[model samples]
Target chain A: MNGGTNRSRFSDLVDDRVDEGVFRVDRAIYTDKAVFEAEIERIFEGGWVFLCHESQVAKPGDYWATEIGRQPVFVMRQTDGSLGCFINACSHRGAVVTPLKQGNANVITCRFHGWVYDRGGRCVSIKNEEAGYAATERSGGRFDLRRIGALDSYKGFVFGSLSSDVPALRDHLAAAARWIDLLADQAQNGLEVVPGCSTYVVHGNWKLQAENSVDGYHVTTLHSVFAATTAQREARDATAGMGRTESGRIKGKVPSGTYDLGNGHMGLWAQHITPHVRPIYEARAWLEEKLKPAEVEWILNRGRNLYLFPNAMLMDNPSTQIRLVKPVSAALTEVTVYCIAPKGESKTARAARLRKFEDFYLTAGMATSDDAAALEAVQDGSLGPPSQWNDMTRGLSDLVAGPDRDARDLGFEPASSCPDWDHEGMFHGFYRAWLERLEKGSGVA
Target chain B: MSTNGIDPALEREVTALINREAMLLDRRRWEEWLDLYAEDAVYWVPAWATEEETTTDPETQLNLIYLKNRGRLEDRVFRIESRQSWASLPLDRTVHVIGNVLVESAEGDAVEATANCIVHVYGKKGAATRGSRYDFAFRRIDGALRIARKKVIFIDDRLEGPVDIYHL
Candidate 1:
């Protein structure tokens, strides 16, 4: 049958022949509609998807709209100041309840039928109640905006899952939280999203961006302009040698490496070359008093490009950005980048933070445009003629098992580590975790 | 009728300079584009705080594009000229259409002008169009007007993909 030929198994797609020093992914995964559908259903919706930061909904009645896979969802701060998440669909007629992307809402009135819901998402009133639902269904949870199956937060980062079958948020996060701590603990009151976000689309598979975040191999080629521009600026500003990966491979003499922090979360770590560019460095004295010696050093100098799998990547270098990837289709990905900073930082530090943010983080910025161009070029090239397997074997020689002295310093227990930053072997954990989920979702395991 | 008390000769000068900037951008005249701005120019594009609100301050707030001086703009041109700028490597083509120009006022040697703009760009990822409003601050230097400050407010801030200086 044609069905059997067309529907290839997930394992066949990701050929992981690690014993032979080979791991490759079929290019069809980037273009096939079926694979995209399965990913949205299994990976994005079925598991924990990051909602917004707790700071986004800090005040009571504050509402933030987002999506879980393709399903529209909204999160709000209840009157009692706790967080609540619900499907954006109105209970009455399925129209979007909160149309505003972000705002404060004392009551959510469905424009479709005038069904009124309070800040907590409970149906308080309805237009002509007697004309519609009976006494049993007029009020209570049944007629309110539907809540997600599960919602939880870890250190101010909120996550929601449409299926209750998922593990607890902390368990799911694991040692990835240690990396998150470097970002979270930087703040006095906690980190804030800084009020605006840069949203744009990429004409490539989401996985391309997912891979690029933790990849150091492409640095010398894809963004030489960044290095050149920074070099000129560094000469002007006399930026010190803290540790800039953009300057290319530092080799030995530095604590630079990569970690597969379990469950597909991966990162590339380095002590910064120009640490002065980072706002956190300006707050070093205050942070040292609040945190341990290791944390102070790790948080300020040895920064990282941390991916929380599936959706978010907390980039602590180039700029502190929370980059969220939403797959619009197999070929298109919507990206939203927000500058996150420790609350109530100095104006000088804040200004420097934003200038750095503008330098590389946005679509309009210098480096990202080149990245977008390169990523799109890769996508275009991958689509031509015959399908082939992509290699992920660059760093196989450098791959190490379990936590290292560097990882142990931060209480991080990654599945694997590579001392060299440019190696490609760290991506194995990401692919393995991805394949496992898809296999389980398709019942192929 | 559209001069708004501005000298008709000065109005023509402003129009010519604006068109010159657009032509240089589309032609990939990177150095020429840099020359059009004053040495201490400010270029800013603010980000939307919400659907209806945009953050007002660049110093203590967020911005889509913010460059305080000509050095940053020079860096932008330098990147594009580096030929390794993949986003701008092939040198994307942009057709900048400007209309409804109004000279708001003349404050001594400086002039405030506003215009409606649409920049159609064709790049590696295909075509992207941006509609925006440009608020410019110009000063007459050596008997010619140079852009001292330029603020571009996008009609739709939810850009679909990567954008750059030439795009708007």
Candidate 2:
């Protein structure tokens, strides 16, 4: 309530009841349209949203169109080889320019009436001899498309924010940046998107999947089928399962810890609620033949999952796959899975990695089956009366507040912790930062 | 049999091979189905419709899925055998109907047959039942036609959710 007092009417329903070991949150957070609208303004717009990588638009005329917080935008490589992002709308009649997903174009022409613009977002041509259109006062900028307010990248992962008041991408990413770097640093030739996407739509809310990304608790209940199959590899001792900080990390990685970087970037290393078990060593000799020893080390082991708040997720080691979620409605979300491989990886090595990936996490996986079932069921429940509150109390007692009110220290018991708090931590941080942007008087940035 | 100037005998042999392969898949006789491939045979599925020229390398093309060489195909079969294979748990039932078996070319060492196929996949995992059709390619390897590629371009390729476990 300290920061959310001026938020939309929906925040008033938040059940702030916190017990010693757990916290009970209201289910209205998932069902309210007002809350959802607030989320688009606060979270999606206020937090750093991943757009694309430097590798994607490396040369001039190269462009990729996508959305950041419901605002359709395109990221293009300028003539000088620098990257810039702008709204995809045309200036003439507000039509979308460069509608294609990806292509190399020097001047993007609006299909509606052929109003053309250069790669630098300058409206260079207005067709049919329009007289006063060039001086139109309503245009957002020189181009009909508005430039993305803030854009930046760490390593090669480029991100853009809609709100001018949100924190810098680097400061917002905090500890999560190292995991993303490890993804590229550990790759043999570094990673690149493997051409096509494995896409599909689910009948559920977008936040459900975002929360599921780091919620280790669901592996036992919702993904029990996956557990039954992977039980062979699940940790039998206290130190083996998800709650333990050293379960999946290298023997000496991170010293068995969880870090809460301020501004909502959370790192739950070695605590992958699910499992990452594939025989990467079988291809190590084959990988070493094409890469240096250090590169092979990075490619074959160490890095795990990296999540930039809101919607993007990356798996660093074994192989790289990015899951980008786009919400179609309150009850439907479209998720696209792009498998990534090193630029010059051998055919055999690439195939092996792809097969291993499909075997474990693709649309053909046990966990995915469980998630689809769960998401649909949650949507069904939301249709009935919304629950008064949703509980997020698992590790509330262990939370040690830092000097910053938004920062806190905690242990790794994400599996049993309330509201799926480990995953919710970053989400809540995103929400708080987003709320600050919407309030007229709140100081942000 | 002679849909497009294809020789009768070659057409019969091609149809028989495809029917046998379909029978193998239906019976879950994976080992036998795999036997019909050439040692260096490549199995591919283009994500989109192709006009005779599409790269077989999954890395280069925007393919829905591709399996290179016999070893890779065998690996796919092995995944189904693995206990953890989530996609194949309720083993999907499919009927592959192959038609329009025409020998586009009868060049040396390899023969290409362009065919139309309607595959019906039926199964239930919880409450979800998924079925689809396939516009496919079958190639004559060492004189007998084999499933070089079975690409099931789903009518809803853009939808989100777990697509069913098996190919249609």
Candidate 3:
């Protein structure tokens, strides 16, 4: 009922008022607390959201804690090798079961009341069980810890949904699977998440980051410092006779475009640089030997920033990165970034990957630092009354259907697409999916 | 502990060098800061976690800040001085508290030293205090101590917000 009430108000906050072929969004959507709460209920809780990578919990009993719609949840690898995702609260007193971020544990015991649950989420033990409960109560299902509605993985990336009515994880991923395959296929032995993460809080709405993840328009302007540094580094390397420049990967003309992968998934594709210095490029022979030629071509040419609707963004350009966006408040978001690499790689290639990752994705990295500041500034400006609409109309005239190669090889129909990298069609497609989800109400109990 | 007491003059010189470096950083004298490093100097700020040992290997471990040589450090300073880094716009005013300077060892021309450092930063957002243990490997070059390697281990590794360009 609350979601329904907010759904009616969302229309007022988001104006489709077109001005000179530009679509404008009102400022209220970014600052409204009610809208934020509604989004948590309708979108986050009612759909399949990414949890953690399967490689992160490869061994049995390994667990990783995270949140789904503000509710603390965790995923653990069972003895049978299946993943079990459970609400982090104990069934007895509702206290958090495991407080640590991640670890290896067969039984997670609630420190509050000592309620223990196995990796399967079955209630296995309780402190003072005989004295605190009757025989009938002890054997009842009331004490069993609740499991998430669904748990599934595609290409080693785990996803969970809070609502049972939502489609399967693969169905939820849909056309996005093609890009996921390209990311995973680059590794000869599959991909693994590198240890450690960089986390920082930003004073901005969560949606801003989701849009910024795939928006290529801001790269040349907002990240001018990074561009300049790279150019200078390349020139210096060439002058010093260093043979090859590491920054050269980002140089020169690379054909770029954006594709709407449907179901709120979108991708920005750009041509890759030389393969000698890149790990993905270095894996070419192995990948060509393993996968089809088209798939290999996708891996070679497809440098992508792929967004999995709601929370996760996988970037294969510059370096492999996985960014998780968590909403703290209507005007606040916390981001966690992780570097991913091929399972087995030479030390030289791995080092190259790490260097590329640190160059742009780290907290002190040029690109992220700029984007964080810019987002906060935008949040500050949205409070003003003069500008009610944010225009997303660049490259609207160049919109085209998805390419035939995508349709034939990946089973992808001609979805919305644009040849230019700096297009607003991806943003429009994202918001369209967002509006549909918000209007559908919270279909989960 | 050293069997023989540290030379008071050596101690004074090392302490003075650190204090001068701090002053140069606070004043944003980019070129002077660059001159304090040897050509092969390494400046590292290792990542921190609650219950894990501080990472020392920049090649394998994640580091908040890792510069391999003087060229990388110079490039970093160049970015800050270019007036194009958005994070440096309206720069945060900072004061460095360098104290408890100790000469841990002296071998050949290289002297290993340890010190306590706390930086208080004031910006438009708010204020933040970053406390760290500074480990320095200094070698005498051109009759003056130049840093061969400087490692900063932050006491509280979890940052309160985005790290300023020059705070470390």
Candidate 4:
């Protein structure tokens, strides 16, 4: 809100004391418009963003529309069956060139001025070319959509960045890439996002969603209703068919852990969850056959909610949901939700995945609704003299220096690890990454 | 196109049942609202897949809500009754306006009808207006009319915030 008039105060927003084990985030980061603008430029546009999966645009001419920060963009399967990401705006007047969320069109015509673009990022035709302009005005660059600086796909997950200063997509993912391999490598073929999406707004800052995505600690309390409903239903022997998986009674928190997969990526993982009812349960035998003993153990029974930082979450705890988080303002965020599954699975497993997806993931679902409500409450209360910081120093005593025993056994190393799954320590890493980005963007780093 | 020999009592009964549904929902009479539904009721709100079309199959496609049986509804009601459903519990003040009711047919002990509904929800979060098309199939069970299926087509596909059964 101050817009950096008080530079010293802005610098002190995050109170991260590693030696003292104290981490407190200034609440202004959630409600300040200035901070939100910085986030859009530095973290979003200046770094990598999760675009749609390869399966979403599998064939030539297939396209998907999305937003990187607040900029409208689209990804398409080029005529040669390669992927291309571009600004959705026309080169002429900046009108959105592709309007549909998903479609197949080899050539797209801007409805505003009749500028046509080919699948390969070429300006095929411009309206009234000879009469309207000389050779210079008709240059290819002026007529085509702006191409993304770097576009890459890691394990079927596509990412785009406008700024070339960031790390490569694989390095950016860091330890989280192995975590994604857990989902992507589930089936012999890769994963595919189920058709159709649910886009809904949450009245809260995007960081609230970022924090909430990997915060396992809040599930027992915040989604008590979901747990209770599932508990009561199981107790009554009514949780049978109609897409309900065997996610047995979600009672108290089980033995779980958290991962600080550096570069702001993190995860909340629990073992011995209802593995029998998980949709992937059907493919467990094949997974064991294909993966190592430790990997199979981790992949089969463990429940995970992995955060890719800034913009996305891949969850498989209650069910499988791919969340694309977009910040609209300090107090508003939009989320695009989808059910993702192995590329080719049995009919029963596919049905169970979709059903479980419907059960507790969407805005209309039992769990996320509560999450949205709680987040709104957090945003509504993000202010004033009584409190300057959000206390985030949970489970510090249990934090291991680097890659705990389980992580080491799995052949992956995280920046840090925690025995307790619900610990808020992962957020400390998130805030650090966030601070670094904002400082670098503002030229203070 | 023509109402030739449509029973006046049937009209009154269907109209009363629909009106009572609105009144009970607005009054937070969840248990009574449950009574209006058959145990095997299919309460569905399909999600739009494209600009002009909704995803057709709930079994394989995405849906805003697709509770196939009354038990799922009961789970929602149970959660709301727990006073822990903060999403819509501590419940919103809702005024449901239902109109344009038309009876499509009457076959044996079943009746089919369609209507339009708009719910004005006011709460601490703010106010939201939800408009939808309600397709209902009512069946006579033990001398009382009960909803066998209720499909709601929401007017606004892009939901602004958390939406619950109360909102729809």
**Per-candidate interface C-alpha RMSD?**
1.4, 6.4, 2.2, 1.4
Query: Which number leads on lDDT?
Result: 4
Residue pairs with clashing backbones, model 4: none
- Candidate 2: TM-score of chain A is 0.75
Chain B TM-score of all predictions, in order? 0.93, 0.72, 0.92, 0.93
Q: Tens digit of lDDT per residue, candidate 3, span B1-168? A: 334577778888999999988899999998998899999998887665323666556876566777777877777777778888777777778899999999998887999999998899886568988887899999999899999998987766434455643676
Docking class of 2: incorrect
Lowest-sum lDDT 10-residue window in model 3 chain B: B156-165
Q: Per-residue lDDT for A105-160 in model 3, tens only? A: 98888899788888888888888888978867856777877888888999899999
For model 4, how does the per-residue alpha-carbon lDDT over A1-445 read when each residue is reduced to its tens digit? 3334333344588898967978898888998877887889888888888987898899999999888877888999998877999988888898888869889997999998898999976788888888888867756476778887789998889999877667888999989998998888886887777766788888899999989888777777887778778767666655554344334224575778888898999888887556777778788789888899888877778888899977999887656788988898888888889888887787777777776777789878888888888899898777654556799888888888789899998877788898887688888888888988888873212
**Cα lDDT, all candidates:** 0.81, 0.57, 0.78, 0.82
Binned by DockQ into CAPRI classes (incorrect, acceptable, medium, high), candidate 1 is medium
> Model 3 reaches what TM-score against the true structure?
0.93
Best by DockQ: 1
Q: Candidate 1: deviation at residue A261, Å? A: 1.2
Winning candidate number (TM-score): 4
lDDT over C-alpha atoms for residue A430 of model 3: 77
Interface RMSD of 1: 1.4
What TM-score does chain A of each model score against the native chain A?
A: 0.93, 0.75, 0.92, 0.94
Q: Candidate 4, residue A86: CA error in Å?
A: 0.7
Candidate 2 C-alpha lDDT tens digits along A106-169? 8998898877888888877777545645456425455456787888888777899776776777
